[model samples]
Target: MLTPSKVLDLYFLEARCMLIEVAATLDRFDRAVDSDTNGDGGDDRIEKLYESLQVLSSKSETPDRSEQLLKLFSGPA
Candidate 1:
């Protein structure tokens, strides 16, 4: 039986590996685009994807319980 910490560690390791693969794939795509003369909207889309991933990977400051409750009741801004 895995402990909670062990499970969390496994999950984190998997996530790290996946993120590394995504970054590498993105890098290759960017290089291919650079070699091509045709300008598609792929660059913009890739940039947005990268930004979103960065946001997802970042740690956010936790709100207090009162703030969390207020948001829960008020719904998203």
Candidate 2:
């Protein structure tokens, strides 16, 4: 197994890049003219996106954040 330092060294930049990309994508969505919040403009996938972001940020008993997000997205359609 890689040491903590090694893991960070190997994955930090890539992870940071992905994080930036995700943020950019969300920002782009918010900027779209058709994304007006006049009514029920959101759906389950958007809700899940935010929920998964929360899962990614939280400290929980589950060590694997991806798995938690997967379950969150996969549960009950």
Candidate 3:
């Protein structure tokens, strides 16, 4: 029932905050990687984060990104 503008008006600030938090986390991670001595910067979890970010940015017709992200972060059953 919500129009596109209405949806943005309701959720834009929250969504923007989340995005900023994610970016900040990534920046902190990059700093850690730069300061790490052993050079083992990333693991499977980091890879999953990167993949989830990709999913968020994908230009698919269907609005299934949240589903894709949920599955991406899920553990083995």
Best by lDDT: 3
Taking the tens digit of each residue's C-alpha lDDT, what string does model 2 give over 1-26? Answer: 99999999999999999999999977
Candidate 1's displacement at residue 41, Å, is 5.3
Q: Candidate 3: where are CA atoms >4 Å away?
A: none
Q: lDDT value for candidate 2?
A: 0.82
lDDT of 3 by residue, 1-77 (tens): 99999999999999999999999998988999999999978778878888999999989899999988998898886
TM-score of candidate 2 relative to the true fold? 0.79
By TM-score rank, best first, the candidates go 3, 2, 1
- The lDDT for every candidate, in the order shown, is 0.67, 0.82, 0.91
Deviation in Å, model 1, residue 53 alpha carbon: 2.8
Tens digits of lDDT, candidate 1, 1-77:
88989988879889789879988988888798788787753745575565656556556586254444344445357
Of 1 and 3, the candidate ahead on lDDT is: 3
RMSD of 2: 2.7
TM-score of 3: 0.87
TM-score, every prediction: 0.55, 0.79, 0.87
